[model samples]
Target: MPTQGWSELGGRLRAMREAAGVSLNAMAAKTHYSKPYLSQLERGIRAAGSDHVTAYSRALNVAADALSGPSQDPLRVAHEWLVADTPVALHREAGRRVGESLVDELERRVIELRLLDDTIGGGDLIPLVRRELADTAEVVKCGSYTEPVGRRLRIVVGELAQLVGWVASDAGNYLEAERTYLDGVSAAQEAGDSALAGQLLSSLAYQMSDVGNPADAALLAKSAVAGARTASPVVRTLLLERVAWANARSRDREATRRALDAVDDAYEERSPGIAEPHWVYWMSRDEIDVMAGRCLIEMGDPVSAAPLLTAAIDGYDADHAREVALYQTWLAESYARAGELDAARGVIERARSAAADVNSVRLIRRVEAIRRLVS
Candidate 1:
């Protein structure tokens, strides 16, 4: 059933695709939508729904809300407005006390955005995340609150900055990511949270390693570890792994090995009753093994890397398509480096299949690089 605005939405979609110089067939391939189905939608014979809008957003590199014009669903309308430039009423009202409840809502929204990042590309999430960060920061700057609530709000700002930074990095906006991370570090410092500040620095370090600044990355990673000495063991373990990666990128095998050993040692210090940070939930044995394998691959020990990558990939949830594709590419690369050409071809094919529908630019670029290496 086509909505009244379907024709207008269809026109915008067609115009956007043309302006981007993307052919209809190319759009179909990128979106995984049938050519006829897309044509029908573009012709206004079919309605543009949420799934369709998301698909188009990823393929066209636009925000999902931009394509979902004048949505009828109340929830969709609310979300669209959330990501829009509409001013917050609380911020407009002078002398409004910022309460714990509002801070709690902001925290909840930040967590939801983080979870959203796991499944969607940074391209699709950038607008929503940027809006959330801006709104939160404005609230902190404009609204009145006690010192305690102020500290919590700043912490939320730090969390949002971390997310926005990571999302920017994923979208290949290195400079934006760097600036956002530094802002987050400042927020964490204001909140007197060394651990969160360290996390921000380590994230920037990871980005540096990815973008060919391994030596700088090594310094930043070590600094992150030093600054967060009082953080939980798991958090320290995660930071140590970043150190290993930076060293591996630098081709300092001895330094890389030492940092990996430290990772294991820190993880061993975990106690049963100590409260774990919510952000460290994804730091686990499997993640550690995957990082170790990736470091080994970086250090030119493909034979050693293969088994670890295989095991981690085997245990990984397939629903996390971007991660699965990323791991598969590394596994494929390891096989190729080991001269297991047949295995490399097979794994790369699987990687390609897994990444076909995942919208992460990083994963797509990785899969292409592995494809080139294997071929």
Candidate 2:
């Protein structure tokens, strides 16, 4: 049989390494593969076997599958694919096609994992999703592509950064989340995607609010709204709502009212031509009602907040245990603030039950806080 296209494989691997920003010397040192051997492999003078593939994959923080072969015997497939005598362009195109397909599948999986986390709660599942995201990032970074391919790679990178930020946020690693969100913002800007940048800024603002920096959060939210001016109406409305929440946190009643009014205006004027980002798909009117109620509660207007919170809790899907728990906790607190002791107790019980279902420490803490408020 003809020797496989080792030269093409070698070139692709070299390109991948460069795209990943890993120096050959650095990879060699990390993998203990020796600089000369790595050079031979990259030049197509020597085929990289499974061992070498694994070592290099580990060094580059990528999935071994990219270097190895097909899922069944990826290392063998990789070696064969590299040395095939067809045009280098053809091989490169094949790799690009494969990478795009994988990226799309990985994106769907990531979204599914996120939805599951909301339903089943966030523990081991988060790390698993992070690992998968990292793998997808590696694939995008490694695969050869034209200019359009590079754009897709940048998009994937930005999305991976966002997912990393959310995972860190769920883990209570707020500082790490902030760093990841910053990375995402840079990637989005580099991709020349203002809508993605706006979403990243909104997420960053939420992270800031989580850390109790309402002023900074409000500023960021406002910046997001301004940046997303040309974005879809739904996106603009979402950003405005976030700004309103931040204003509520900062006790800027007039600003909060203005932001809320903007949200209403945007919603009323929403056109079928406008499209929301996938991440904001769950943000419906009921969710907005919950958000507004929470703002009211923070503003010490429990009488005005109670009904909205109750409506949100009632509207929330029971399958989303963690969110249900959070909404229930908010409801309980609202009832307590309104001095409805009996109703507060019942809501607290539901909150505790939902908290148990999710096993979320944060939700448990909220439940405790609600109980204290009622007591």
Candidate 3:
């Protein structure tokens, strides 16, 4: 196998293990490998033979053939065959698979954006992604695939559009972002994908709130909530939380209370049957608490905000080091608001250390804002 091929496979395996919530020890026990050995395999420090691949596939409950197949080799004959195939039938099938892979790539990129938050620097990747997305959209618009495949393609397009919107918004090009998001909403509607529409609307609302248009944000958030009723329970919970977020930004006491109530209602209704989209995976209870805390701080209730913000900063995923830092900055601001200068200074030091690990303009801007508040 090419080195890059092994590296990509290792990365995918690691991602799968993380997504399934399997600890390294648990994976080792299931695969009958030593913990250190498994770690090496995941890090691509050791080449995995077919037997090891099979064992891992079994442990991960995925197809052994798929995991250990010749396709795993980027320079393998099968890859060449796919690349060189020119027959219409073969070309179509290959294109479909490539499109699917691109969708997965897009999803991964979105996760990176969320975790790193603007720390990656520059907007260079955005246009490349948008071009790929436009290609996918064209394939779907052709409507040559069967209904099931076409539906999947449309969903991918919607997701791509949402990502485009996010990148545009981050780059401070709100008009383009709005157009992209609106396009996504329309595509979702065409595919009867109400959940995706709600997600796009919620993202747009978040952008609006960040740019100081709380009233418009709240309106968009309400529309998201209305559309979310047709989504799965987990989606509804996230959308409701977003509604709370918008209301909190608007500083509308009654609206905020009602939005929080709605969040509770949705959370209470959540069940195992409710399938969550990949984008909403990080919206945990801790994140919701942070949103509430931010809202309270904006409403001039520092007494109520401090503890919640503290918990939020503490509960943030450590692997998302940049986000943890951003939350810490917010926590410091909350402490300063409550006249706890020593505590605020301590948190600021932590934030500064974390910021060093990730060079994000957005995080830097947030730190500047907190400094202005405390000083």
- For candidate 1, list the clashing residue pairs, or say none: none
TM-score of 3: 0.69
Score each candidate by Cα lDDT: 0.81, 0.68, 0.67
Please give each candidate's TM-score. Answer: 0.76, 0.70, 0.69
Candidate 1: give its CA RMSD in angstroms: 14.3
The best candidate in terms of lDDT: 1
lDDT of 2 at 11: 66
For candidate 1, write residues 270-303 as lDDT tens digits: 7533545557756668889999999999999999
Which candidate has the top score in TM-score? 1
Write candidate 2's Cα lDDT for 216-239 as tens digits: 999999999888778777777788
User: Model 2 clash pairs?
Assistant: 4-83, 5-82, 5-83, 5-84, 6-83, 68-74, 68-75, 69-74, 69-75, 70-74
**lDDT for predicted candidate 1 compared with the true structure:** 0.81
- Candidate 3 local lDDT, residue 53: 58
Q: What is the C-alpha RMSD of each candidate to the true structure, in Å?
A: 14.3, 18.1, 9.5
TM-score of 1: 0.76
- Residue lDDT tens for model 3, 1-375: 112344455666777778778999998889767788767667865444434555677787887545543332212322343344322234356654334444444344333333233233224335544664676677676535566666666776787788778766655677888889999998888888989999999989987887759899999988987876777766887887777778878888788878877776776676433445656645556776777777777777877987887877775535455568777887888888889988888888788777665545556677777877776
How far in Å is the alpha carbon of 99 misplaced in model 3?
9.1
